[model samples]
Target chain A: AQSVSQHNHHVILSEAASLELGCNYSYGGTVNLFWYVQYPGQHLQLLLKYFSGDPLVKGIKGFEAEFIKSKFSFNLRKPSVQWSDTAEYFCAVRGSASYDKVIFGPGTSLSVIP
Target chain B: EAGVAQSPRYKIIEKRQSVAFWCNPISGHATLYWYQQILGQGPKLLIQFQNNGVVDDSQLPKDRFSAERLKGVDSTLKIQPAKLEDSAVYLCASSPAGVRAGELFFGEGSRLTVL
Candidate 1:
């Protein structure tokens, strides 16, 4: 089974502050990476995804993630975050050989100060 | 388009009791998945189905948990003699089969509590 690790379990940042969430995967193979977010009382929504093409993938809400194969890392970052960005972020992966079996990291909780 | 829909937004049951959760996937999605999300933890894939056939159930506790997606549309997951450890939110998701980069659309999830 492939395991994913998020360096920060909880993060606190003020409005307009730069944000970065670290994600690392254990599997070394053809994999698809993704970041999902869940706001309070809402279902999980897609933040961004990295398939093949470029390592840097931009997603909704001015967020992006860079896929670093050499480091086995796909870190999510944003230049400035808003209070709306306060939510639970999850990093997920699916190996091509696994028949699309998706695996998710524990998740990182982000709280944005007003 | 309508997203995945789940019933019984919340449920509470005693240990050794039986409970069931239902899911209705997107109108035309070919793949459906069941996941368990414990508090402060990520969602764990419990089972996956391709249409009406079972694709994966390796992580499911066969002795107590059973799921079936009959008629290739709606699915139901049942846990008999549920344990305390089974207390968690159950999420139902769906995706287009063979779509390598497609994201799984998730439901609001059914929260469960067992005493």
Candidate 2:
């Protein structure tokens, strides 16, 4: 059974603070990883994705995630957070051979304070 | 280009009732998907359709859930005799054809509250 786990349920940070959201998956085969964000009253939007090539991927709004194969993790990070960064983030994975279906992690909620 | 479109942004139904959600994918998209997102959780894939064919329905609860994509453009997801646990947001998404890593465009979603 494949599953994605988001360790942090909720995180609160002041403006300009660094942000890191942990994500781990239990799959040995090749996988496609994605990070999605949902702001208040908005639909889910793709932040970034990791297919092949590089392990470090940058996305919109100054977000980035590094895929660590050894650790089975693709943790999202931001150097400096802003109040507008408050939203819910999700990590997802799909098999490399075919994008038949995607499995998503529970989700992590971030609240940025000014 | 317009993103995926879903109707009835919100719905409130009693348990054991029936409900349906409609989705219109972006023009020329060949892949469509339905997902259910419970409060405070990530969206869960319920079904996937490639054109007019069903590619995957492994996660869908067939006993109470059914979906169809007639003509391969628009889709409908229905829940019969809905249960309290069915209270969630139903999202519809679509992607372009022949791309291995195509990004999915999601709709606003239809929120269902089963009282």
Candidate 3:
């Protein structure tokens, strides 16, 4: 079975701090990676996705993720985070070349103190 | 375009009861998805539908859970004899067909509380 792992369960940072959330997948075949965010009381929304392009992908709200094939990792990063950026983040992966199911990691809750 | 729409934003039922939730996908979207999100956890795919046919349902609990997209436009997910563990938010999402990597548009979600 394919699975995604997120190293951070919960993170607390002051405003304007840099953010990095680690994500790794357990799949040997080609994969599509994604980052989704859910603000408080809001539905899940896509942050960014890695289909088959440059390893570094930029997303909304100043978010970006680097897909490192060598490490089987797609880590989400931001140079500066604001209090509004506080939310629950999820990392998901689906198999490429096939319409396989998308698997989600446990999730990481980020809290940015103003 | 409007996002996915779900009905009965919140539901509370006792264990062993049956409950159903409805979802309406975005216009012209052929792919629909249903997910279960437990508190403090990420959403888990429960089923996926392409048009009026099921594309995937491996994670759905067949014994107690079932879902269908009758006209390939609207969908319903039902849980019979709901268990306490079934308390979670049910999310509905949809994407354009034939796209290899399209972002999903999600609804507000139906929150279920199985007491």
Candidate 4:
């Protein structure tokens, strides 16, 4: 079965610190990658997605992700993060067209202190 | 545009009790999805529907869980004789565009606790 994995389960950082959450997946074929964020008391929101083209995809809230097919990884990165950026990050993937189910990683909880 | 709506922000039931959750997807959304997110974990896809038809439910425990989207709109998910492990947040999502790709709007989710 296909699965997604996030290396860090919990992270704490000061405001303005750089952020990088590692995500990796196990799939044999092409896939659509995504990064989602869930702020407290809020629903999950899209951070960015990679369907095709450039490996580096920019998303809302100064977030970006790079899809490295060779590593089966799509890591989320932010040069500087604000306290408001503290939230749970999830990496997900669905098989390119042929697969329907979108698999999500366990998640990484980031706590940004001001 | 309105996002997906879910009812009963939270619920607590005994292990053997049955529970149900309701969701109303965004208007005109052809694809609807049900996901379960346990504490400290990412959302897990339970079922998917495209225009009232089942698209993918491989992860759903049909023996104790069932879901339906009537008329390709509103949806309901039910769990019979729920177990303690069934405790989790149930999320409803919609893809206004086809299920092909891109963004998915999600509801605030209904948290369930089975004692």
Candidate 1, residues B1-115, lDDT tens digits: the string is 9999999999999999999999999988888999999999999999999889888898999999999999999999999999999999999999875544347899999999999
C-alpha TM-scores of all predictions: 0.97, 0.97, 0.97, 0.96
Candidate 4 local distance difference test against the native: 0.91
Q: Which stretches of candidate 1 lie over 4 Å from their true place?
A: B100-102
Residue-wise C-alpha lDDT for candidate 3, range A1-114, written one tens digit per residue: 889999999999999999999999999798889999999989999999998879999999899999999999999999999999999999999887445677889999999999
Runs in model 3 deviating more than 4 A are B100-102
lDDT of each: 0.93, 0.92, 0.92, 0.91
- The chain B TM-scores of all candidates, as shown, are 0.96, 0.97, 0.96, 0.96
Model 1 chain B: weakest 10-residue lDDT segment is B95-104
Per-residue lDDT of model 2, residues A15-79, tens digit only:
99999999999886988899999999999989999988889999999999999999999999999
Which ranges of candidate 2 are over 4 A from the true structure? B100-102
lDDT of 3 at B28: 92
Sort every candidate by DockQ, greatest first.
4, 2, 3, 1
Clashing pairs in 2: none
Better of 2 and 4 by TM-score: 2
Q: Which pairs clash in model 3?
A: none
DockQ of 1: 0.64
Candidate 3 lDDT over B5-95, as tens digits, reads 9999999999999999999999998888999999988899999988899989999999999999997899999999999999999999987
